[model samples]
Target: MNNSLTNRLGELAKLFFKMGVISFGGPAAHIAMMEDEVVKRRQWLTSEHFLDLIGATNLIPGPSSTEMAIHVGYIYAGWVGLIVAGASFILPAALITGGFAWVYVTYGTLPQVAPLLYGIKPAVLAVILNALWRLGKKAVKTSKLLVIALGVAALVLLLNVNEAIALLIGGLLGMFWLHFPAKRNSPEDNTNLLIAGLTTGATLKATAAVGASAATASAANVSLWQLGLFFLKIGSILFGGGYVLVAFLQGGLVEEYGWLTQQQLLDAIAIGQFTPGPVLSTATFIGYIIAGVPGAIVATVGIFLPSFFFVAALNPLVPRLRASKWTAAFLDAVNVSSVALMAVVTLQLGAATLLVAKAPYVDFVALAIALLSAVLAIRFNINAAWLVLGGALIGWLFFTLGLYPIK
Candidate 1:
C-alpha cells in the first residue's frame, strides 16, 4: 500500500480499537460511534455509501455492524484493511466483556457490575431506538419499502417466524419486485456489480470454504472449534442482522449445548449493550465464561470470520450486481426482513423487562431514559456517549432516591 493508504489504515485500526473498548450500548451505539469516527471524523465514506453498506449488511445473517466494519475496511484499504479493521474493532470489547464474563462465571455474581449495567440498559434502549429511527428514515424511502418494513415488523411480532427465513423471503420478494416491476413501478436499477456476482451459489460456497479454513487455523480448543463451526454455519445460512443471531445463539448455546443458563445468557446480552462495537461480541463474553481467554479468541474469530469471507468474495462483483434488477430486488427483500427481525427482538426485550421478569424493575427506568434519549437523539442529534452518561445519571438518581434498591 502507498504511504497515505498505509497511514489511513493505521488510523482506522487505532480508531476501531478505541471504539471496541469504549463503544458501549449495543449495535446501534456501535454504529453511532462508527459514524462519528469513520463517516464524520475521517470522512472515509459518504453517508450514502455508509447506509448502503448498512443495508447490505442488514440483508446478511451475521452482525450487521461488524460486517459494516469489514466493508469500511474493504473500502479504505482493500483486503488487508478489511482484516485489520474487523479484528481491531472486535478485539477490545471481546477482551473486556470476556474478562467480565470470566469474573462473573467464576464468582457467581457481579456485585459492582450489575448496577452499571442497570443504568446502561436504558441507555442502550435509547441508542437502539435512535438507530431504528435513523435507519428507518433512510431505508423506508419509497412507499414500497415502507410497506415492506411495516409488514415485516408485524409478521415478526405476530407469527414467530424464524428471522433468517423471514429475511430470505424478503430478499426473494425484493428480487421479484426488482426484476418484474408493475406498470406503475420503476424498472430495477442494477448499479452495484459486486452484489450481482454473489447471486450464484458457487461463489458463496467457495467463500464458505475459505472461511472454514480461516476458522480452523485461528483457534485451539475443541469446544472453540465446535463454536466456530456452529457460528460459521449460522453466518453462512443466516440472512438478517444482529437481532436474528440472538435466537440462533440462544438455541445453540442454551438449548442445544446447555453451555449457559438462561440467566447467564441474558446477563451476557445485557453486558453486550453496556459495551461497544457489535452486540455479537456477546460471543466473546460467552466464550470467556465457557473456556477463558482462548475461548474468547475462538468465539470472536469464529463469529466474525464469515463476514470477511462473504464481503471479500462478493466485493469484486458488487458493481455489476448493483445493476441487476433481480439482485436489487433480492437485497431489498432481505432488508425488509432484517428490520422485521429487529422488531421481534425489541418486542421480546420489552416483554422480558416489562412483563415476564419481576426482579429487574429497574428496566422500566431504563426504558424511560431510553425514550427520553431517543427524543434527544432525533431532535438535537446529540452524541450517544453523552446520552448514555445521562441514562447512567438517571439510574443513580433512581437508586439514591429509593425508587429501587441497588442490586
Candidate 2:
C-alpha cells in the first residue's frame, strides 16, 4: 500500500478502537458514532456513501456497524486496511467489555451498574424509535417495501419465526419482485416493482440452514473445541445485528451447553446492553463466567473471528455481490426484515421495562423528559449522547427527590 494509505489506515484503526471502547448503547448508537466519525468528522466518504454502507450491512448477516467499519477501511485503503480498521474498531470494546465481564462474573453481580442501565434502557428505547423513523423513511421507498416490512414484523412477532428466516424470505420477495415483472393483468402486478424485486432475491440460503445445524451440533457435543466452534459458527452465520446475537447466544450457551443459567445469561445481556460496544461483548462475560480469563479469550475470539473472516472473504466479491440484480433485491428485502426485527426487539424491551419486569412505575416527569428528548432527536437531529446525558440528569433528579428508589 502507499505510505499515505498506510497512514490513513492507522489513523482509522486508532479512531475506531477508541469508538469501540466508549461507543456504548447498541448498534444504532454505534452507527451514529460511525457516521459522526467517518462521514461528518473525517469526511472519508459522503453522507450518501455512508448510508449505502449502512443499507448494505443491514442486508448481510453480521453486525451492521462492524461491517460498515470494514467497508470504510476498504474504501479508504485496501484489503490490509480493512483488517486493520476492523480489528482496531473492535478491540477496544472487546478488551474493556471483557474486563467488565470478568469483574461481573467474578463478583456475582453488578448492582451499581444495574441501576445505570435501568436508566439507560428507557433511553435506548427512545433511541431505537428514532432510528426506526429515520431508517424507515429511507428504506421503505415503495408501498410494497412497507408491506414487506410490516408482514415480516408480524410474522416474527406473532409466529415466533426465526429472524434469519424472516430476513431470507423478505430478500427473496424483493429479488423476485425486482427482477421478474408480473404480467400486467396479474393481481399482484400492482405491487411496487423495486420491493417485489428485492424480496424475490432474499430467499433463505441453504447454507444458512446448514450453518445453524452445525452450530447446534457443535454445542450439543461439549468440548472446549466444540464450545469455541459453536460460537464461531454462530458469529459467522448470524446476520442482522447484536440483538440477533443475543438469541443465538442464549440458545447456544444457556440452552445448549448449560454453560450458564438463564438468569446469568440475562444478567450478561443486561450488562452488555448497558455497557459500551457491541452486544457480542456478552461473549466475554460468558467466557469469564464459564472458564475464567482463558475462556473469555476463547469466547471473545471465537465470536468475532467469524465477522473478520466473513468480511474479508466477502470483500473481494462485494462488487459482484452488489451487481446481481437478485442480490440487490434480496438486500432490499433483508433491510426491511432487519428493521422489522428491530421493532420487535424494541417492543419487547419496552414491555419488559414497563410491564413484565418489576421496575417502578414511570415517573411522569422522567417520561416527559424522555419524550422531549425523542422529539429533539426526530425534529432537531440531536445526538444520542446528549439525550442520554439528559436522561441521566432526569434519573438523578428522580433519585434526589425521592421519586424513585436508587436501586
Best by TM-score: 2
Model 2 collision count: 26
Q: What does candidate 2's lDDT look like per residue over 3-30, in tens digits?
A: 8987987798787787776565677667
Residue 257, candidate 1: Cα error in Å is 7.0
Report the C-alpha lDDT of model 1 over 1-407, residue by residue, as the tens digit.
Answer: 68988897897798788767656655545675676567655788865556556556654546667777888898898888999998898888787777778778788865355555567666666666656555555555577776676766666667865554455556665666646755443344433323343443442453244222222221234466776676667656554445556677676677666777788788888767656667778878877777787777777777778888877865665544445665655655555555555555655655544342455434556567667777887677776667766766777777768886553
TM-scores of all predicted structures: 0.74, 0.75
Could you tell me which 10 consecutive residues in candidate 2 have the lowest summed lDDT? 198-207
Best by lDDT: 2
Indicate the residue-level lDDT of 398 in model 2.
71
113 in model 2: Cα distance from truth in Å? 1.5
RMSD versus native structure for model 1: 5.7
